[model samples]
Every structure is written in structure tokens, then in C-alpha cells.
Target: MALLNQTQVTPASFILNGIPGLEDMHIWISIPFCSMYVVAVAGNCGLLYLICFEDSLHRSMYYFLAMLSLTDLVMCTSTIPKTLCIFWFQLKEISFKECLVQLFFIHTFTAMESGVLMLMALDRYVAICYPLRYATILTNPVIVKAGLATFLRAVFLIIPLVFLTKRLPYCRGNIIHHTYCDQLSVAKLSCGNIKANIIYGLIAAFLIGGFDILCIAISYTMILRAVINLSSADARQKAFSTCTAHISAIVFSYSPAFFCFFFNRFGSHVIPPSCHIIVANLYLLLPPTMNPIVYGVKTKQIRDCVLRILSGIKNTKSHSV
Candidate 1:
């Protein structure tokens, strides 16, 4: 039987999942993924432009949206291009070091994105529950501090993960089932006893994923309570409507991750690999695409600003003609 030493397993096992196929994969998957990548980038770029150019959008809500767009962009940038190269361009087998870099950035940005979403939920709760306090609570300094702290926390927490993976030996088969270096998949590749890694990964997931989701739920609960006390039905409806898109995005993002972690633990490995990749892509891509559209519809100022920006561009074109 083959044996693994301390240096046998490359860090790349944690970054690139495996070079399973250079040819046999369906073209259909690659094409749609490319389309989604384009849409995600374009949508996020448009949101950034709208926020930067439109002075009226300088408010706390829109500022938070801008940060959300940035996080979504990071999320897409981290996963999509590499995935495309693997699936479409036939560029498989990333270097061990490159894989670790990818793993770090992917987890960091994703955790940060989750943290930002939780903060946004809190922002909404503050806005709806204590309208007067919204400015005080969601000030630039406060938002900046929260963002910085969240980022630092994600970076610091995941630092240990890199070191842990680096120490694992890879004597057994180096094949990872998924496209990317997911925790469980990577752990399965380790030749050493991986009970510790498994426990750590599950704990990290519970702490980061479970904790963030819990915070979001609590924020929404408080918001709901405040909404209930509102005398006007219109007020309650309007408040809830503003949160609908965010709620949808959160549910979409969290549910699949939950399913992947929980269901796969039991005997239900029925979910195919392709489905997992698609859902992961959706979580990163869909939010940026939907946010501007939803917020534009929900907020009158944003709607008018987008329309005016469109009109101005058209007028400029007409004048040039």
C-alpha cells in the first residue's frame, strides 16, 4: 500500500478539486456558466457606476448596496473564471500553490460577503424599527468599522485552515469529486487521519455559517416585531417589500450550503456534482444581477436615478449624432 509523508500532499489539493476530465464533460455546462459570469460582472459594474455617479445614492442604504455589489463581484471573480478555464478552455491541473491562493480568497470573500449581508439585514432592521436612529447607527464610520472588522475576522479565522491543510499528507488517491477544493472533499483526499480536520471544518462551518444566519434571522425577527406595531398597513407592507429581495437572496445563498453540508453527511449523496456547481454559481451571480433591479423597483429615488442616467446617456448620443 502507498504511504504519504508530511510533504506528499500538495496544497493544490485544497484549491483545485481535481483534473477529472479534459474532454468528457458536456459543453452545455460551460456555455451557461460563461453567460452567468458575464452577467454577474456587468450587473455589479452597473451597480458600482450607479452608486458612484448618482450623488443622491450616497445614502446609507445605497452605500450598503454598493458594498454588497463589491462582495458579489469578489465572489464571482474568485470562482467563475477558474471554473470556466477548467470546464471550457481545457486548462486543468492548477499548481498546488495557486490552489491554496484560490482557496484562501474564495473562503475569505465568501465569509465577508455573508458578514456584509448580515450587516445589511441589521441596517434594514434599524431603518424600519428606529428610523431616527438609522443615521446614527449606520453612519460611515460605523459601516466602515463593521466592514473592516468582518474582513479581518474572516482572514484571521481562515488562516489556520491553510496551515492545517498544508500539514496533511496525501498518500492515497488525490482525486477530489467536486470542481473546487471544498473542505470535505479536500479532507477526503488527505492520507492522514482526518477526524481533526473534519471536526474543525464542521465547527468552522457552524460558527461562521450558522452564526451569520442566526444573526440575520434575529435581525429580521426584530424588524418583524417593529413592523407589527406600525399603525399603517401601508407602512408595514412597504417595509416588508423592501426586504423581500434581500430575504430571497439570503435564503438562496444559505439553503444550498446548508443542504450540501447537512444532507451529504447522511446517506443522501443523491445530489449530482453538476447540480452543486450550478447552485454555487447561482449564489454568487444571482444577487448582483437581482439587487439593482429589485432595489430600483423598491426605492423611488433609485428608480428615477437609473432612468435619468439612461436618459442622459441617450441624449448625449443624440447630440453627438
Candidate 2:
């Protein structure tokens, strides 16, 4: 038994069970997943292009938005393509090292996303509450520093996860019961004690989710107070309208994520595994897909830019005809 344990410690690879009871539907499932992946990629890339090129979008708000879009792009890309491969080609094998790599990207980008959202909230808070000093507050250097801080926070926080997972002895058979490599799911496969993994994972999740959510809430609260005090009705309306996209983004990003997290940790026994897995995929895919749409619809600047580009293309086609 001891020799068997020693030999099995290093698994050549782990087989990903795409979705436990939905094996037959994997092909069908890939269709929508593929469609969302395409939309997320195109939309985020469009935002990035517009932000980089459009002189009008060179504001602190758009700068933060560009960061958010970039984060969304990387977060979804890290998981969705491999998920599609698992669903479509039946290519579900992932090496231990590759799994850890995926785990790092997924978690790191998630933390980064949360950080970006917090920054967006802060931007709005400052813009609304301290209109006079908004320019001075979020200067180019400050925005750059904030972005760098978020990136570093994500990197430092997630690098340990890789090491913690690496040190584990995977004596159990290498079958991950999900589409992609989830930290908890992979940690659970280890024969060695995983209390450290669980504790650290919970801590990391709280540090990212709890801290960000709290800050966002506080920022919005102050923004709300400031808006209410404005003398003109139009001013109040404008203030609230500016936040519509950010609020939608917050809902799209955090709601499913927190649900999936708690469900995976606490309600796994009661909830269906397939449901949990589906929500987990959504937690990754939905935000990237919806965020761009939300911003495009609600943000006048981005919407106008998109419209201008479309008009240009239309005119070019008409001239060609």
C-alpha cells in the first residue's frame, strides 16, 4: 500500500469529466459555449481597440474600463477554450502541471477582475463625490500604479496556490469532475491532507471577493449620498445613469461567482453536480460575454464609437457597390 501510494503520487495526467451526468450532451453544450467565447473575445477586443485608438476615450474612467475588458478577455480565454475542447473533441486529459497553470490563470484573472471592478467603483465614487479633484485624483500615473498593484496582488496571491497544489501527493485516481481545473476540485483529488488548501483557498476567495465587494459597496454608498444632495434633477439622473453599466457589470460578475463558490463548498451534497458545474462555467463565461454588451449599451462613449465604426464600414461597402 505504501509503495502503491508512493508510485501514484505523480499522476501523468488527469481526465476531466466534462459534466458528470451530461456526457451525452457535451457536443450540444459546446455550441453555446463556443458562441459565448466568440462574443467575449470580439467584444473585449473591440473595446480594447476603441480605447487604444479613440482620442475621445482617453479618460480615467475608460482607462479603468479598458483594464476591466482586458481582464475579462484573459479570464474567459483561460478556461473556455479548453472547456470547449473537452466538450467537442472529447479531449479531456490535462497534465498535472498544465492543470496547475490553468488554475493559476483562472484564479489570478479572477482576482484581477475583482480588483478592476473595485477600481471602477472608486473611479465613479471620486468622479461623483469629488468632481473638482477628479482629474487630480486619478491621474495617468495613479491609474498605472493602481493597475500594477492589482496585477501584483493577483500574481502574489495566486502563485502560492500552484505551489500548494504541487506539493500535494495525488494518490487517488486523476479524474477531475468538472470541465476545467478548479482549485478545490483538484485539491480534493489529493490523498494527502488538504486542509491547508481549503483554508488558503477560502482565505484567498474572501480576500478577493469580500474586500472588493465591501469597497464597491462603500464607494457606491458615498456616490449615492453625493448624488442625492445635487440640486438639479438632471444632475442626479446623470449621476445614476453613469453607474448603470458598472452596476450591471458588478451583478454579472459577482452574483454567479459567489453562488458557485458557496455551493461548491457547502451545498455540494444537496445541489446537483451538473448544476454546480454549469454555474461554475457561467461564473467564468457570463461576465466576459455580458460586460461588453452592458457597457456598449449603457456607455454613450463606447456606443457612439461602435456606431461610428459601423457607419464607416457601411459607407465603405456602399461605395464599393
Candidate 3:
């Protein structure tokens, strides 16, 4: 339908901006952005690889970590490459179809991250709140089902926007203010009525991502209560300690995201353009880069596995040399 609409009317392409006022500094700015992208990709990939290859790490928590790594990697890939092109190569033009593709993957993966975080919260809740029944409650098949549900939820909610966006008439010039295609950024460019599109986007975002955040908060609250009820101080400490990794991961993931949300919605006049833009980019890059380190430090099992893997590679290199 969007393609049909595009046949008659639509911009041929859209130009993406890196950081509006910092055009001259794009090359320099891209250096740190590029470094973060590389670290995020490498760190997430290594974590995923560790989870897959290590038998001991094959459990519910690792399962959610795997999902998160995949989602974050996709989100990073969707934006950073094109962003690099704009900054370094000065190639800002992106075709309409390609822009939509980028838009779908970016938003879909972002929502997927929220879904996976919810799953992780549930896993922690079950493990802490029902220790004896944890195995029975979240068996391997059940974990697989949870992951599938996460994937379907993310995809189904965002897929409609693809068609809706495709059908909108684009009379506005093709220059997008940001580095990538997004719902609000794209919808604002339409020549026709955009109330429906904006309304639907808000509904989907809140229904899915908002619901996930609410559930996560509830899950943690229960987990905290359970921890406090334990008789021994050591037991309480241990249980709370176990949650630090998830808590850190959640903070790294959501802090920048919510800041970006507010910065976009309410900071138009208050926050400077460069500050908001930097926060927006960090919202996409910070989680994957920090998640692994948080988990490694907070969860001994992951840290041990990572160390073993690194040591094995080092030994191999020494023998070869």
C-alpha cells in the first residue's frame, strides 16, 4: 500500500543530518561514536558467544542476555553504519524504501530490547520469589516460548507503521533532522493528516514498551520484598546481590532512553541542540556497550566464563608464537 502510494507521490530520497549545528565537527564527533559502536558490537557479540559456548551459562538469565545482545546489536547496526556514512563520507542520501527498512529494524529492535528486559525481570522474579519452583516454572521449552512471544510482540506492533508510513504523502523536503529514520521524524514530513499515524505510534509504544517497564518495576518490587523477608542477613544480601547485574543493565538501558524521550518531547526549548543529540545517540549505543561489563562484574559466572575464554585465546596465541 505504501509502495502504491509512493508510486504517485513521495520524496525520491531523504537526507540525514548528523548533529545539525556540529556539521563541521562530524568527522571528529564520529570518532567517539565509531569507537562506541565498535565496542558495543564487539562486547555484545563476545557475551553472546560466551553464553552459547559455555555449558554452565546455559540457563534462563543467559537466555535473556542472548536475546538482549541480538536486539542491541541489530539496533546499533541499523543506525551507526549510515550515520558513519553521513559523517565521514558525506553520503547523506537514503532512498525511501531503504529509509523505511532502517526505520523498521531500529524501532523493532528497540522494542524487542524492552520485551527481553521484561522477560529477564520475570526470570529473576521466579528464581527469587519461587526458588523451588523456578525450574518447573521456567523450563527450557517455556524459555523458548517467552523468547518467541518477545519477538512476535516487537515485530507485530511495529510492522503496521511500515505500511502507514509508506502511504503518507511526502510534500515536505526529504531532509530528515536526525541520523536515521524514525516514526516521529518521518511522520512529521507527511503532507497528509498525520494524527492517525502519531496516535497509533504512541499507542503502540506505550502498550508494549510502557507495559514492559511497568511489569519490570512490579517484578522487582516483589523480588525486593521477598529478599527482605528472608530470615538471615546473608541470605538477604545474597539475593539482593544477585539482582545488581540486572539492575545495572536496566539502568544503563533505560536511563538514556527516558532522558532522550523527555529531551525530545519537552526539551526542545530548554536543552541545547547538541546536548539532546548526544543523549539521543547514547540512548542507542550505551546499553550494549555497558551491559556485558555490568553482568561480568555483578555475576561471577559470566565473569568467570569470559575470563576462561580470554585465557584460552591467549594460550593459543602463545603456543602459535
Model 2, residue 283: distance off in Å is: 0.5
- Which is the better candidate, 2 or 3, if ranked by lDDT? 2
RMSD for each model, in Å, please?
3.0, 1.4, 2.7
lDDT of 3 by residue, 1-321 (tens): 877566436877888876889899999989999999998988889888888989999988898899899888998889888889999999999999899999999888888898999999999999999999988889999999999998898899999988899889887777788888877788788888988887888788798879999999999999999998999999999988888888888898888878877765677899787777777778888887788778778889988887887899999999999
* lDDT scores of the candidates, listed in order: 0.72, 0.93, 0.86
Model 1: per-residue lDDT, tens digit, 1-321?
123343365443433442233336535677776786787788778878888888888877777788888887887787778777777665666666666676677777778878888888988888898898888878888888888887887888777786677677775665555566655566667778877777777777777777888999899999999999988999889888878867866775676566566645763467566566556556666665566566667678777887898899999999999
TM-score per candidate: 0.89, 0.97, 0.94
The per-candidate count of clashes, in order, stands at 0, 0, 0
List candidate 3 segments past 4 Å from native: 1-8, 314-321
TM-score of structure candidate 1:
0.89
Choose the strongest candidate by TM-score: 2
Query: lDDT order of candidates, best first?
Result: 2, 3, 1
